[model samples]
Target: MNFNEVISNARDSLTVKRVYGDPYEKDGLTVIPAASVRGGAGGGSGHDEKGQEGGGGGFGVNARPAGAYVIKDGDVSWRPALDVNRLIAATGLAVIVYLISRPRMARARAKSSESPSES
Candidate 1:
Protein backbone atom coordinates (compact mmCIF):
# COMPACT_ATOMS: atom_id res chain seq x y z
CA MET A 1 0.00 0.00 0.00
CA ASN A 2 0.98 3.66 -0.47
CA PHE A 3 1.38 6.39 2.13
CA ASN A 4 -1.76 8.21 1.02
CA GLU A 5 -3.76 5.01 1.07
CA VAL A 6 -2.65 4.22 4.61
CA ILE A 7 -3.57 7.69 5.83
CA SER A 8 -6.94 7.53 4.10
CA ASN A 9 -7.69 4.20 5.69
CA ALA A 10 -6.85 5.55 9.11
CA ARG A 11 -9.11 8.55 8.61
CA ASP A 12 -11.95 6.38 7.38
CA SER A 13 -12.00 4.39 10.59
CA LEU A 14 -12.93 7.50 12.60
CA THR A 15 -16.59 7.72 11.58
CA VAL A 16 -19.71 8.76 13.43
CA LYS A 17 -20.86 5.19 13.61
CA ARG A 18 -17.59 4.22 15.23
CA VAL A 19 -17.74 6.99 17.80
CA TYR A 20 -21.33 6.25 18.76
CA GLY A 21 -22.22 2.61 18.85
CA ASP A 22 -25.45 1.21 17.48
CA PRO A 23 -28.47 2.13 19.54
CA TYR A 24 -30.14 -0.71 21.32
CA GLU A 25 -33.60 -0.69 22.78
CA LYS A 26 -34.15 -2.06 26.24
CA ASP A 27 -37.24 -1.70 28.43
CA GLY A 28 -38.75 0.76 25.95
CA LEU A 29 -35.63 2.91 26.07
CA THR A 30 -32.91 3.45 23.49
CA VAL A 31 -29.38 3.53 24.75
CA ILE A 32 -26.60 4.82 22.56
CA PRO A 33 -23.10 4.47 23.87
CA ALA A 34 -20.77 7.33 22.98
CA ALA A 35 -17.02 7.48 22.92
CA SER A 36 -14.05 9.72 22.20
CA VAL A 37 -11.95 8.57 19.28
CA ARG A 38 -8.54 9.70 18.14
CA GLY A 39 -6.24 8.58 15.37
CA GLY A 40 -2.84 9.43 13.93
CA ALA A 41 -0.85 8.48 10.84
CA GLY A 42 2.76 9.05 9.86
CA GLY A 43 4.69 8.26 6.70
CA GLY A 44 8.19 8.73 5.38
CA SER A 45 10.08 8.06 2.14
CA GLY A 46 13.78 7.95 1.33
CA HIS A 47 15.84 7.42 -1.77
CA ASP A 48 19.54 6.48 -1.69
CA GLU A 49 22.13 7.20 -4.35
CA LYS A 50 22.15 3.52 -5.20
CA GLY A 51 18.71 3.97 -6.75
CA GLN A 52 17.03 2.34 -3.79
CA GLU A 53 13.76 3.67 -2.55
CA GLY A 54 12.09 2.94 0.73
CA GLY A 55 8.81 4.13 2.17
CA GLY A 56 7.01 3.36 5.39
CA GLY A 57 3.89 4.40 7.19
CA GLY A 58 2.13 3.75 10.46
CA PHE A 59 -1.34 4.44 11.79
CA GLY A 60 -2.90 4.17 15.20
CA VAL A 61 -6.33 4.66 16.67
CA ASN A 62 -7.61 5.00 20.23
CA ALA A 63 -11.09 5.10 21.65
CA ARG A 64 -12.32 5.76 25.17
CA PRO A 65 -15.81 5.71 26.57
CA ALA A 66 -17.06 9.28 27.02
CA GLY A 67 -20.72 8.89 27.89
CA ALA A 68 -24.09 7.58 26.80
CA TYR A 69 -27.40 9.03 25.65
CA VAL A 70 -30.41 7.56 27.33
CA ILE A 71 -33.71 8.09 25.59
CA LYS A 72 -36.76 7.18 27.57
CA ASP A 73 -40.38 8.24 27.22
CA GLY A 74 -39.42 10.71 24.51
CA ASP A 75 -36.93 12.40 26.79
CA VAL A 76 -33.19 12.34 26.42
CA SER A 77 -30.63 12.38 29.17
CA TRP A 78 -26.88 12.26 29.07
CA ARG A 79 -24.95 9.98 31.40
CA PRO A 80 -21.27 10.68 31.54
CA ALA A 81 -18.68 7.96 31.84
CA LEU A 82 -16.28 8.08 34.73
CA ASP A 83 -12.58 7.89 34.07
CA VAL A 84 -10.54 6.80 37.07
CA ASN A 85 -7.35 8.22 35.67
CA ARG A 86 -8.87 11.64 35.19
CA LEU A 87 -10.36 11.60 38.66
CA ILE A 88 -7.02 10.75 40.18
CA ALA A 89 -5.31 13.49 38.22
CA ALA A 90 -7.89 16.03 39.30
CA THR A 91 -7.53 15.03 42.92
CA GLY A 92 -3.77 15.29 42.72
CA LEU A 93 -4.05 18.74 41.20
CA ALA A 94 -6.42 19.87 43.92
CA VAL A 95 -4.07 18.69 46.61
CA ILE A 96 -1.16 20.50 44.99
CA VAL A 97 -3.19 23.72 44.75
CA TYR A 98 -4.25 23.50 48.38
CA LEU A 99 -0.73 22.82 49.59
CA ILE A 100 0.60 25.81 47.65
CA SER A 101 -2.12 28.14 49.04
CA ARG A 102 -2.11 26.93 52.65
CA PRO A 103 0.66 29.29 53.76
CA ARG A 104 -1.01 32.34 52.23
CA MET A 105 -4.32 31.36 53.79
CA ALA A 106 -2.70 30.96 57.21
CA ARG A 107 -1.07 34.37 56.98
CA ALA A 108 -4.39 36.03 56.14
CA ARG A 109 -6.13 34.31 59.02
CA ALA A 110 -3.37 35.33 61.44
CA LYS A 111 -3.53 38.98 60.33
CA SER A 112 -7.32 39.04 60.81
CA SER A 113 -7.07 37.48 64.27
CA GLU A 114 -4.41 39.96 65.52
CA SER A 115 -5.75 42.67 67.91
CA PRO A 116 -5.87 46.15 66.43
CA SER A 117 -3.15 48.31 67.98
CA GLU A 118 -4.50 51.43 69.74
CA SER A 119 -3.83 54.41 67.43
Candidate 2:
Protein backbone atom coordinates (compact mmCIF):
# COMPACT_ATOMS: atom_id res chain seq x y z
CA MET A 1 0.00 0.00 0.00
CA ASN A 2 1.03 3.63 -0.50
CA PHE A 3 2.29 5.67 2.46
CA ASN A 4 -0.81 7.91 2.44
CA GLU A 5 -3.18 4.89 2.40
CA VAL A 6 -1.25 3.25 5.28
CA ILE A 7 -1.38 6.47 7.35
CA SER A 8 -5.10 6.89 6.67
CA ASN A 9 -5.86 3.31 7.75
CA ALA A 10 -3.87 3.71 10.97
CA ARG A 11 -5.63 7.00 11.74
CA ASP A 12 -9.05 5.40 11.13
CA SER A 13 -8.29 2.64 13.67
CA LEU A 14 -7.04 5.15 16.30
CA THR A 15 -10.10 7.30 17.00
CA VAL A 16 -10.14 8.64 20.63
CA LYS A 17 -13.22 8.78 22.93
CA ARG A 18 -13.55 10.86 26.10
CA VAL A 19 -14.59 9.32 29.50
CA TYR A 20 -16.65 11.84 31.57
CA GLY A 21 -16.10 11.38 35.31
CA ASP A 22 -13.95 12.36 38.27
CA PRO A 23 -11.07 9.93 37.84
CA TYR A 24 -10.47 9.90 41.62
CA GLU A 25 -14.07 8.96 42.60
CA LYS A 26 -14.86 5.44 43.92
CA ASP A 27 -16.38 3.05 41.39
CA GLY A 28 -20.06 2.83 42.43
CA LEU A 29 -20.18 6.43 43.68
CA THR A 30 -20.32 7.84 40.14
CA VAL A 31 -23.75 9.27 39.28
CA ILE A 32 -24.46 7.09 36.30
CA PRO A 33 -28.07 6.38 35.23
CA ALA A 34 -29.80 3.29 36.66
CA ALA A 35 -30.29 1.82 33.18
CA SER A 36 -26.58 2.24 32.47
CA VAL A 37 -25.65 0.18 35.56
CA ARG A 38 -24.22 -3.14 34.41
CA GLY A 39 -25.48 -6.14 36.33
CA GLY A 40 -22.96 -7.99 38.54
CA ALA A 41 -21.26 -7.57 41.92
CA GLY A 42 -20.11 -3.98 41.53
CA GLY A 43 -20.42 -0.45 43.00
CA GLY A 44 -18.71 -0.90 46.36
CA SER A 45 -15.00 -0.34 47.01
CA GLY A 46 -13.00 1.13 44.14
CA HIS A 47 -9.80 -0.45 42.87
CA ASP A 48 -7.68 2.14 44.67
CA GLU A 49 -10.03 2.62 47.66
CA LYS A 50 -8.56 1.43 50.97
CA GLY A 51 -11.29 -0.69 52.57
CA GLN A 52 -11.96 -0.72 56.32
CA GLU A 53 -9.75 -3.04 58.41
CA GLY A 54 -12.56 -5.63 58.84
CA GLY A 55 -16.04 -4.08 58.69
CA GLY A 56 -17.97 -6.24 56.23
CA GLY A 57 -21.49 -7.42 57.10
CA GLY A 58 -23.43 -10.69 56.82
CA PHE A 59 -22.25 -14.30 57.26
CA GLY A 60 -20.91 -15.91 54.11
CA VAL A 61 -23.03 -18.28 51.99
CA ASN A 62 -21.04 -21.28 53.29
CA ALA A 63 -21.83 -20.48 56.96
CA ARG A 64 -24.10 -23.12 58.52
CA PRO A 65 -25.13 -24.87 61.75
CA ALA A 66 -22.65 -27.10 63.55
CA GLY A 67 -24.41 -30.31 62.45
CA ALA A 68 -25.38 -29.11 59.02
CA TYR A 69 -25.00 -31.44 56.05
CA VAL A 70 -21.88 -31.12 53.93
CA ILE A 71 -20.81 -32.69 50.69
CA LYS A 72 -17.60 -34.76 50.63
CA ASP A 73 -16.06 -36.79 47.85
CA GLY A 74 -19.11 -36.15 45.65
CA ASP A 75 -21.39 -37.52 48.36
CA VAL A 76 -23.76 -35.76 50.78
CA SER A 77 -23.29 -36.40 54.51
CA TRP A 78 -24.11 -34.96 57.91
CA ARG A 79 -22.74 -35.21 61.45
CA PRO A 80 -23.28 -38.59 63.05
CA ALA A 81 -26.06 -39.05 65.58
CA LEU A 82 -24.89 -38.90 69.22
CA ASP A 83 -25.23 -42.10 71.29
CA VAL A 84 -26.60 -40.92 74.61
CA ASN A 85 -26.67 -44.37 76.22
CA ARG A 86 -23.08 -45.15 75.33
CA LEU A 87 -21.98 -41.75 76.59
CA ILE A 88 -23.71 -42.28 79.92
CA ALA A 89 -22.23 -45.73 80.33
CA ALA A 90 -18.74 -44.53 79.59
CA THR A 91 -19.07 -41.66 82.07
CA GLY A 92 -20.40 -43.96 84.79
CA LEU A 93 -17.52 -46.41 84.24
CA ALA A 94 -14.99 -43.59 84.49
CA VAL A 95 -16.48 -42.44 87.79
CA ILE A 96 -16.45 -45.97 89.19
CA VAL A 97 -12.81 -46.50 88.19
CA TYR A 98 -11.77 -43.22 89.83
CA LEU A 99 -13.60 -44.08 93.06
CA ILE A 100 -12.05 -47.57 93.19
CA SER A 101 -8.53 -46.22 92.64
CA ARG A 102 -8.83 -43.33 95.10
CA PRO A 103 -8.15 -45.42 98.26
CA ARG A 104 -5.19 -47.25 96.66
CA MET A 105 -3.67 -43.98 95.51
CA ALA A 106 -4.14 -42.46 98.98
CA ARG A 107 -2.43 -45.46 100.68
CA ALA A 108 0.49 -45.28 98.23
CA ARG A 109 0.86 -41.55 98.91
CA ALA A 110 0.82 -42.17 102.68
CA LYS A 111 3.50 -44.90 102.40
CA SER A 112 5.71 -42.62 100.36
CA SER A 113 5.29 -39.79 102.85
CA GLU A 114 6.19 -42.08 105.82
CA SER A 115 9.34 -43.40 104.16
CA PRO A 116 12.65 -41.90 105.44
CA SER A 117 14.81 -39.82 103.07
CA GLU A 118 18.09 -41.52 102.12
CA SER A 119 21.36 -39.60 102.75
Report per-prediction Cα RMSD to one decimal.
2.8, 25.7
Q: Please tell me which predicted candidate would have the highest lDDT against the true structure.
A: 1
- Estimate, for each residue in 2-116, the C-alpha lDDT of model 2 and write its tens digit: 4445445544433321112222224333231111111111112223356543222211112111232334444555444355777899999999999999999999998887848
Q: Against the correct fold, how does model 1 do in TM-score?
A: 0.77
Q: Which residue window of length 10 is worst by lDDT in model 1?
A: 110-119
Clash pairs, model 1 backbone: none
Clashing pairs counted in every model: 0, 0
Evaluate model 2: give its lDDT.
0.43
Candidate 1, residue 44: the lDDT equals 89
Local error of candidate 2 at 15, Å? 73
Cα lDDT of candidate 1 equals: 0.93
Report the number of the highest-TM-score candidate: 1
What is the alpha-carbon RMSD of candidate 2 to the true structure?
A: 25.7
Give the TM-score (vs. native) of candidate 2: 0.34
Give the per-residue Cα lDDT of candidate 2 at 35.
14
**Compared with the true structure, what per-residue lDDT tens digits does model 1 show for residues 4-119?**
98889997998998799999998999999999998899898999999999999989899999999999999999999999999999999999999999999999998888888932
